[model samples]
Target chain A: MSYELYYWTGIQGRGEFVRLALEDARAAYTDVAREEGDDVMSAWLDGEHEGALPFAPPFLKSGRLVIAQVANILHYLGPRHGQVPDSEAKRIYAHQLQLTITDLVVEAHDVHHPVGAGAYYEDQKTEARRRAKEFRESRIPKFLQYFEKALERGGGRHALREFSYVDLSLFQVMSGLDYAFPKAMSRHDVPLLRALAKRVAERPNVAGYLASDRRLPHSENGIFRHYPELDA
Target chain B: MSYELYYWTGIQGRGEFVRLALEDARAAYTDVAREEGDDVMSAWLDGEHEGALPFAPPFLKSGRLVIAQVANILHYLGPRHGQVPDSEAKRIYAHQLQLTITDLVVEAHDVHHPVGAGAYYEDQKTEARRRAKEFRESRIPKFLQYFEKALERGGGRHALREFSYVDLSLFQVMSGLDYAFPKAMSRHDVPLLRALAKRVAERPNVAGYLASDRRLPHSENGIFRHYPELDA
Candidate 1:
């Protein structure tokens, strides 16, 4: 049975992390919200249909099981798709790294919506500018340094010794940050991460997906938005 | 073998979620950082020790296996301590709820540190005020309502049908929010969540721990900080 993924359709937001893993593994899945309208995603959020109720979208349904949270979804898919090691210890290690990535993602989103998620970006531009300054100056470098050190420890090929979902996620996050803060990212030194993103993109299945129409472009409506003022 | 939990002293913080489960199960574990000193925690963060490297603290070491992240630690301890269901699907569901709680905790922290975690809370008072306004007005109510609806769906006892680590975590989040924003939380109506918090507090092991010296008081340095002006 094909896995069914439900998320917002317009941009490569949090859902992209999960999508990248499925595509990298050449797993057959359906992007439910993209095929069926936003109403279907809204209905699940409203609890109109039943399984395990997700607080938000980007949930996966496979047979009788449903899972939410990007890391959790990847955790389930990792071993099945040969993206992560089989040992219990390595699995936990991969999860720890993924959780840290999740932290970076939250911080990235907060740069734009520091004051509020419900408010418009125009309304919170002042606070966003301040938040983005700190993000570019401190957070981005610190997080990149952590990933760089991890990559070095793992022999500079993947997040672990071999290719894994964590590597795929790191690639997606790097791409998003590069798109959102081209000047800042270029100024910062993250050679290891940049190399990993290029490596992941060249994978046969990943390259095919990126070249195909299934991949969505980064837009302002998503988590990583490029407002020129926030970059500097 | 006893578990070794490494976290900062003086504040419940993220470590409390793991502590509550260990305490609730009457499991034998050593609070290493509290017993030792900050140096021990610092060394781990600096990657001086072996095993999987954690980007930060609140990591657990069980024999040769080491795990980090609050949710990941709880996910490891839940089934081992009889705090979660045995089925894979239920375990995944419990994890999803715990991830939601993690998201809420991040928001609570951001209310005080809107600009950057490296800076002092007093330095970002202006941004804090704006962030807190949005948090108190929309984020808290929406999160509490989501938990309330989850509790209602689970028969008003726990986040799941049975007592799980998710319940322990929900209780901690509610207590922290109450201490941080007594005025705002009191004004908001989250009857189901409030009731669940009370229920979890009354559990035998939970009550014992709360009455013991191990239960640290909420302080300004922790994730949930009480700044009166921001609350208003």
Candidate 2:
């Protein structure tokens, strides 16, 4: 069956997390938002489908199904796409890891949009600086430590070994941090993270996707941005 | 199999979302943190099991399985426990709604903590005014609108015909907003949400839980605080 993914057209945003798992699993799916003049994302949220509807995008459609939330979408597709463990317990564990990655993603977004989403990043620069410092100094390390321990247990450096969905997302996390806070991340004791990123990059499917046209470049438009002041 | 729940003692926090679902389903589980003493939250985060480990609390342990992330845990248990949809599509939609509720929870916490988690609400009161105003003005209506539409789609009143996991979370969100911004929620167009809270409260299990000692009350020590200054 052809799976349809609904998300914004241009930026990777949260959709990239879902994309990584699908690409890594070699799942056959169409990126619906990028399709020509479809307006499918809005349609999906506008209640075109039956059963339960998603509150927002990065949702998936498999036949008659419409699934949403980045982690939830991945959780729904984990076993089917060959990206996670089969048992009920391991499945929940994989989703738990993805949700934590999602939390970090929100923190990353708030580094730029601290005061409010309606207010421009420039308008909230002061708050962003304060939030960014806290993010860089405290949260990043705390979250990374957890990921490191997760990696340590899952088989070290590879983060859930065999390169799961969370690993790909973590790779993006390091990539975004490096782009947004080059100085701080460069100074961080992230040898394990760096190694894992390198491994994720070397994965044939991901390497191909990164080199291909489908992969979007890091931009000021997305959650992670290159703001020199926010960086340490 | 026995389900073991790991969350902080004293306050419900994010764990209460899962706790409500578990209780409503009458699922048997141990509140690990309360059992081992409140400070045991840290050790629980440290992974007190073999195989898979949780990065933080508000996790669930079923048999040898350890799961983290409140939304993920609830999504994992909701169906089997009869608190959620049975289909994959419906399941993901329920999860998406729950994740959005989790977002609101984080946002509500940040209403008091826009500065940083490392800083106290007292230290960040000034910044919180700016954040809380935005939350009340923009975020509340925006999220409440989404819930309103979901209710409309589900045939009005309840957000999914029968109560789902997100409906339980919706009750908590309503409860939280009421505590955080009494005047704002009181004046807002959150009729569906307010109604959902009443419905969830009247649920035999939920009402019983809320009345029982098992339910934690809202206080200044938790996410939704009745800071008179913070309120409208």
| Clash totals, every prediction | 0, 0
What is candidate 1's lDDT per residue for A68-176, written digit by digit as tens? Answer: 8999899999989999988888899999999999999999998999877878899889888888988999889888998898888788888888889999999999989
Q: Share of real interface contacts recovered by each model?
A: 0.84, 0.76
* Candidate number of the best TM-score: 1
Cα-lDDT of candidate 1: 0.90
Each candidate: what lDDT?
Answer: 0.90, 0.80
What's the CA error at residue B144 for candidate 1, in Å? 1.1
After aligning candidate 1 to the native by TM-score, how far in Å is the CA of B65 from where it should be?
A: 1.4
**lDDT by residue for model 2 (B23-64), tens:** 888888888778887676666667555756676667787766
| lDDT of residue B204 for candidate 1 | 96
Q: Compared to the true structure, candidate 2 yields what TM-score? A: 0.94
Cα deviation in Å at residue A65, candidate 2?
1.6
**Residue pairs whose backbone atoms clash in candidate 1:** none
